[model samples]
Target: MINDTIVAPATALVKQAVAIIRLSGPDAYQLINKVFSKQVEKKQNQITFGYIKDDSKVIDQVLIMSFVAPHSFTGEDVIEINCHGGVLVTTQIISLLIKKGARFANPGEFSQRAFLNNKINLIQAEAINDLVNATNETSLKFAMNNLQNSNLHLIKKYRDQLLDIIANIEVNIDYPEYDGVGDVSAEELTEKLVSLKAEITRIIKLSKIGKIINDGINVLILGEPNVGKSSLLNALMQEEKAIVSNEAGTTRDIVEGKINLGPLTLNIIDTAGIRETVNEIEKIGISKAKNEISRADLVLIVIDSSRELSLDTKELLTLTADKQRIIVFNKIDLIDPTKLVLENFKNERIALISTINNNIETLVNQIMESYHFEELTKDDSLVLANLNQISLLEKVENFIKNAYNNIVNNYPVDIVNVDLHSAWYLLGDLIGENYDDNLLNTMFSKYCLGK
Candidate 1:
């Protein structure tokens, strides 16, 4: 058990409505009792209002909440001082706590302590950080699901099944001479391993969707000059983020904006139009556009429906042949509706839009249709967002595959047991059943102080 008391300012140190100073550990109550004027009752989970005093001087009017051991966040005695907001009052209270024998808390120390006390597992601890740093609604939902122990429960289920298999293997090895107990054949073991591998592989594939949700999709906008690329950017962003002009080569640099499409954030980048230019700066911009296209998750190739297709546009179509792209025909307002013929580009995904007339919703819907958002969200709870967790899951899957291979090749049960055991330990580590101090330190160090 952790013996020393810890203290930290749980809220921002700026001028606000209130700031909370938190303390946890053995001396939590004693430290607060020394400075708080209102006598704190021995009652657990009580909130008392009083003035904080340093001898005869009054520091601030404050509200103090207390939690008894084993019921608190850290599974220890905990105190939270809700003082008037500002740097002066909060700092004074913290400094007074330090003088009263409370040491400053390290980053994620409280959460780490909770893990050590068996209050939460590794997945939940990491989820706490994810929840704190979540940028969008989807990310927040993903983190909250994991914090509720959804992933922990799933991992435990898999681990328990593996344990049963391992136990049966042991029974077979130990009771070779017993006639009453039937031996588990190699085929039966392989079947179980295959089923486990399929489940894990499904989760791994789901993690890819989780990653896209965490880090918004990158979209590149490409077209010849003056084909309404900037206009489309403004329309999508609902702001004049990029300067729109009829003049060619107006946008000689990359302009970026973000749009929320049904829980997904599309990081749309508007780059210089791809065309032959004698200007050095335009050439540099064109080069940058090519680089962005190669990295884009989705590419939008804008075309002017009123004008005939140019050689540059044909070349762009060929360049993006292997990429997921949409041929967006802009300036539809200027073209005759019946005169437009899409027979040449019928094989490619196409959208007709008029950016000036604010008719880009169809284009947005087309982009959304390309991703499997509905299916991904159907079972969105407790997605594996951390790279480390995903990597460990991959390792577990590989080990199971290896074990199945050994069984198929008629290897001894003892050899298959090695692979099974390795898989079990790796899954255990994912849930913090076994961990080293260095790994714990690294994981918790990413959290902000007082979390």
Candidate 2:
């Protein structure tokens, strides 16, 4: 259990009318009472008028409310003070709390405590942080849904199912006197194992989609010199973010921007054109372009309609063959309608456009279709895959898979039991049931002072 009290600023640093200073832990109330003098009869759960003081000097008139232990966040007493939000005032109040025996809260300490105190599970705690950092409306909705449907509910369901299977196997082994063979058949046990394994696999697949939503997909624009690559980037961003020119190698560096497409946010990067060059700087630019293409979630292969397909353009197309990409026939306005050949790269995946003509809506739709952004729903729940969480889930899925294989191969129930129990332990680690001191210290230290 956390023995010390922690205090932090619960609101953003932006200029606001008022700021909330939160204190949580066993000594939350004690620290609050030290600096604040109640103006009215104070009762539990009631917000009373008060004036904060420092060494008998009045600071500001404020509203202070006390939440007693076990009913508040962190499962400890929580006290919140609504004080005037000037930076100086908030800093002075936090300094006063520190001097009054309350320690500074870490970057994510408040939520971390909630997790440790069994108030919320690992996923819900993560959701709280995700909601705070959400960049778009879709991301915020997903985080809210995840917080509402606690991860503990999902983990407990899986744990209970596994427990029932284990209990049945134990009864068959120990209570041979009872009608074990007829009551719980080996075939029924194998079926249940297979079903559970499938469910685990499905959840693991969802994590990939969750990762995409939590962190936007990266799309790199690649093409030969002066193929209107920068033009496309500017059009998609709805601004002249990237320099555009008819001269070859005008863009010598990568330009990056974000574009919201449906529920997906695409991080678009405009890279230097790929071509063999004798100039030292141009060669370096070419190398950087290659690297961007390799890491791209989608490659926008741009081709100038006025010029015939060049050797460098062919090379770029071949390089991006393995990546998810869409071909763009740009400068459509310059091309003669009768002379334009549509046979090559002619499909739903190819887009015809002209940045000058302002005809890139088709290209945007193509990107949305390629990434399957339409599939993400407003109501769908999303969970991010941080390193710690991904590792735990991987271990659990692996153990469940092993148990299912053993059961299907007609292996002994005792052998399958080992894998089943391993799965249980992995899930426990996600919710801090199997946490250690190092994990606790590492997690809490990320919080900022006065969090």
Candidate 3:
């Protein structure tokens, strides 16, 4: 049981209509009684209006709510004070609470306490953080689903299957002569393991899609000097984010912008034009552009249709031969339409557009098609947003595979149980059945204070 009371401002410490100051612990009621002037019976889950005072000085007119232990968020006596949303009022109330024997809550202390009190599992706790930081609707949907125990349901099903397998293996090892409990053949065990591995593999693939949903796709704009790279960036963003100029090497740094297409967010980067230059700053910019190219999920190679492809452009084409790229023929409005021959460029992933004329919707549609954005968003699958969770699942998959391999090689069922048991415990770690304090501390440290 927690002994000391903890207090924190649950709302932003800015001027607004109302702000919430939360307190949780054994002394929560006594601490509030010392400051609040309301005389209502301290009933559980009831809100009461009162004036907060510090030695006859009214701090703020507030509404205080009480939550009894075992039914509250943290399974402790909790008090939430809603006061005027001003820096001074919230600060003064928190200060008064601190002086009246309540300590400040650490980051994610409330959620950590909830986990300890069995109110929420580890997956739900992590989902809360995801929901708070979700950047798009798809991410929010996945986080909400996880918070509702969707992932827990799927994981529990797998865990139960593994547990049954282990139990049967144990029974065989302990009572091999018993006629009533028939032996589970090695072939039967391998088949079950194979099915489990397939399910886990499917989940891992879906998690990759989830990662993209949570973190926007990184795209790099790459080409030689004076190829309308900056212009293309401005067009895509529909704003003058990058400085455009007729002069070469005008953009000597990377400029970035983001756009949401359906549920996916495209993080577009406008980089310095790639070319040989004696200018030291231009060389640095080119180097940074190359680095960005290496990290990009998609590369948009802008080509000037008004001019023939230069030797530098050929070299760039050779360099990006292995990357997922779309060849953009910019300045089409300035070029003769009949002279644009398709026989020269063989790449199927190509687009003809003029940023000056504002013809970029087709290019955007091409990008969407390349990644199958619509199909990915339409499906309802359990997508693991956390890297640690995905890593654990991969480990579980590997263990299952190893067990299958051992069974194929005629290893004893008891020996195969070792890997299966390890897999089971790892799954438990994913859902907080088996967890370390250090892991919990690290996970909760990423959350905002008072969460």
Top candidate by lDDT? 1
Considering lDDT, which of the candidate structures 2 and 3 is the better prediction for this target? 3
Question: TM-score for each prediction?
Answer: 0.92, 0.88, 0.90
Which lDDT tens digits does candidate 1 get at residues 423-443?
999999998999999989999
lDDT for each residue of candidate 3 in 1-451, tens digit (9 for 90 to 100): 6678899988888889999999999889999989889764557799998899998999999998899988899988899998999999999999999999999998899998989888899888988999998887778877888788755777898999999999989999899889549468887888999999999998888777678668887889999888899999999888999999899999999999998767668899999999999999999999999888778878899989888888888887787888888989899999896798667568658888899988987788778777644434443466788899999999999999999999999898889999999999999999898999998999999998878
TM-score, structure 1 vs. true:
0.92
Tens digits of per-residue lDDT for model 2, 1-451: 5799988899865578999999998877767777877543334687888799996999988998777767777777888889998878887898999999988887888888777778877777667766766766556766786778634566777888888887887777777788845356767877877787776665565666556656777888999989899999988888999998878998888899997776668899998888888888988888998988767878899988998888998898789888888889899999785687767665427888898877998898787676333333334423444556766777888888788778788888789889988888777777667878777777656544344
lDDT of 2 at 316: 87
Per-model C-alpha lDDT, please?
A: 0.88, 0.78, 0.87
Lowest-scoring 10 consecutive residues by lDDT in candidate 1?
A: 373-382
Which candidate would rank higher by TM-score, 2 or 3?
A: 3
Using TM-score as the measure, which candidate wins? Answer: 1
